[model samples]
Target: METGDLVRELRTARGWSQGRLAAEVNAACGTALTREYVSGWERGKVRPGPFYLRALAGVFDVPQAALDAGRAPGRAGGAAAATTAALAPSVTSDLLGLGFAARLRGGPSADDWEARLDAYGTDYMSSPAADLQRRVAEDLVVVQQQLDAPAMWSAAARLMTVYATTFPRQESARSIQWFRTAAEAADRSGDVGVRVWVRGRGALALGYGGTATGLADLLADQALALTDRPSVGLLHATLGKAYAAALRGDRPAALHLADRARRIFDAAYDPSARLSDYSIPAWRMNGFLSLLSARLGDEKQSAKAREAALCELPERLPRFVTHLELHKGLTLVRAGDREGGLACARAALDALPQERWCGTLQMLMAEIAA
Candidate 1:
């Protein structure tokens, strides 16, 4: 096929109308590329230049030269993009919910992450959005081969604690490998921030299935004291601590840290959104706080926390954040009201953040029934 023919063929194959293609390309670029422009390119009336090439590469996920050569596109769903999908565990669907939420809050550019790497290296432990922590973790898995990239590795270390809470019993050896690689990469760079990040990862791993001794408190301390000063990541660590304490039935300690985390939001940084705008502020602790209060039978506090979390939460959460709603729903169900709890669970099920969690939540429902 000629250029126009190729474009038409690929676009049709993906079932993308000009508008869909334009929207995808627009998302890839930092700016919107209109439908008319998309129309022009597909018709081959005007060849796409380098800018178009980069944007198209992101959209089609193919090498620019290949796309130009009229080769098949490399998208996860499209013909050419199948390689990475096949090689990886197909985590894109899970990560995309995270990415889309992040994209809503912040534009994705390699340069932005590169700059974050540099800034974080100096003081890596502090001040991170939830999305950054998550992306850095997933990126380590995708680019573990690029061990030379210190910035990437540094970011990855910090992200470990975030995902650990989300993935509890589901943690895998691959997850540990990613964490170890990131930690080692940070150590090689001699980035203290990375060290703090690494410690957080270790603490998180321990909490997941290993040691629990002082895990919560020690993690918060390491995250805070590792660098020149306390970092927002310390709060993230605290969040993990709170979760761990809850698992331990240490209601007082968990609630204390969860409350502390909520308080920290008052002084939180205003980073641009990534994956989801909600990840930037790193989610409303009030949600957890409310749920915790419910678990503890603090009716007044539970209502308060719920109101705050619901208010602070953006109307439309990125898919990644939505996954936690299931856990929250479960907490509600186990509290006292089966019908209301099931309703909450149904809402989360309907939202369908990530597919992997589908089975987990389904099982959780069965357990709740039993």
Candidate 2:
């Protein structure tokens, strides 16, 4: 096989277009290459330089030697191969065969769709909302046509969760519309777990604005009612209710709810689980507690939660870590260190990428400055 043939095979095996391949290469190598370049290279009209060859090797998870040899890389044997083999199916379909027809099919396979959703969920806290929203919207167009399939219901629901969160909080109507769609999808899926997940996430989205406490409360109640199990869903619902209580100026109730959320988190959290939006990490729970405590003017509790959140914080989630710092600033403001608190808040905002800042962060900053 020629290098071009090998490149085309690998790209098509992953169901990527020339444009997608170009995007992946650019992302990996920080290059400005385009689909036209990808087309030229695959047609043997142009050859990649050493730099691009190395970039392509990394993107394709193959050795530079394999590309140079103009052959497919040898697969490993046994269980690991069994697991990954389906992800890289043989690209033997020629234009006429049923295999070729299926290869040209529009919708993603169940596993592919699920993996995409999982990636979206895992990247939610780290990626810019606009970027994440664009990616989710692209997938939504394809998934929307297949919602009648029970297998696609969970995908639809999860995609709606992304839409619900990515919309600005001030756009409550748009956000709630997605939340409602997610609820409908979850119900149609008939998966109790997904139903709980949607309601819990919806409650949090509604609670963030401080004006939709009633809707947040209702969603949280439904989330809890759907499951007696100790789960991430339960933790989120409890946190949502805690936020609603805090917004309503019921400090004791908020504190109690936060404590309950912590217990559910302790019982349910799986250290081995994939780190996605569907799973509540200790850091996220602590951050919420810190924010809620700060809002209630409980400086000590807020400080403890802030420190706990910081200690377990992951490097990828800068926005969340920044929010935790803002919570500390809020505590400082409540303690009369007005100038220091404002400085702290400003520093936190400065450390985060401006594109990732959202309405919730702005609200926190406003509270600290006020």
Candidate 3:
């Protein structure tokens, strides 16, 4: 097989687009290779350099020799030959280890589904979107099949939350659809906690996507009503409502909800609780508060929230770090530091994966530009 054929086959097998494959290659090798470059290589118009070849090997989990042999006209037949010699061992091992045949016949275990959900959250911002979407689709199948199992509802809820957060702008309808499915599954399984959590996430998605702020408020209010007492979920849902109010230019309502959310978070938040994708940490809520205060033109409160966010920065994920920076940048802009804010916003955007450039970030960038 030719190298181009091999690259194309491996990428297609994993359900990756050319751009996504290029992104994965760049992430693996710490080099910037563009979609056009990948397209050229796959079209046989250009050959991959050593760096790209090695990166492709890592991305596809194959040997360098296999890629090299694929490029050699007389070395082997094409991807078929390379697959037989280079891919068989790993493929067979994965099939056996994952119980591929059995899973197809009997569905995945709840534990397996939970593990995949956790993995999705752990790598939410870093992984290639095409790969992540494929995994989510596969996991959703298993989750749907196991909806009667209470534990699976938790997994399903997490999956929906991650899906909504990761693809808020690009897949708005699909995200909402899955969120509804997650809520229904949780309710059917009698998991009110998961149901409320999913509703809160759905509200955030709606607000962030600028789809319907009223619906966002309704969902958040519904979630708040479902919680009996103070809880992290209630805090998140209140914050979601606050965020919706902020986006809608309702300053008084936004500030009131922000204060309410903070009070609940202070009372109910347990540091030792296992953090899921849906769980909003104190630092993240602070960041959101900063954005809300900035939007409400309360420079003093915005600065205070910014300080709190910065103090808690070290505990955040890279994704949240960038998010916090964006919030801080917006606060700075609201304080009349346009140049400084633009620079900080640009830096945060550059630090994240391209697939993670959602509507909220885009709106912040527009504000900075203005």
* Predicted structure 1, TM vs. truth: 0.49
lDDT of each: 0.52, 0.75, 0.67
Quickly count the clashes in candidate 1.
15
On residues 1-370, what C-alpha lDDT tens digit does candidate 3 reach at each position? 7889878887877778999997765433335679998889889999987756765764564556767778532232333344345436965465344445444576667778767766675566355555676566555545655555678677777676665554434334334445555566667657677777777777766654444456567778888888757766677678778877887788888878877887887888777745554455666677777777777778788778778877876554566666667777777777889889889889998988876566556656665676
Better of 2 and 3 by TM-score: 2
What's the residue-level lDDT of 211 in candidate 3?
Answer: 48
Preferred candidate (TM-score higher): 1 or 2: 2
Model 2 per-residue lDDT at 261: 86
Q: What is the per-residue lDDT of model 2 for residues 1-370, given as tens digits with 9 covering 90 to 100?
A: 8888778877887778999998766543335789999898889898877767766765665655566667765433322232233233532122123333433575687799888988887888678887887677656666776666777898888788887788653344445556766887888888888888888888876665453466678778988988879987777788888988987899889889988887898899888877788777777787888888887988998889889888988887788888888888988888889999899999999988889887677767876776
- Give the higher-lDDT candidate: 1 or 3: 3
> TM-score of predicted model 3?
0.63
Give the range of the ten consecutive residues with the poorest summed lDDT in model 3: 72-81
Worst 10 residues of 1 by lDDT: 168-177
Give the candidate order by descending lDDT: 2, 3, 1
Which residue pairs in candidate 2 have backbone atoms (N, alpha carbon, C) closer than 3 angstroms, thus clashing? none
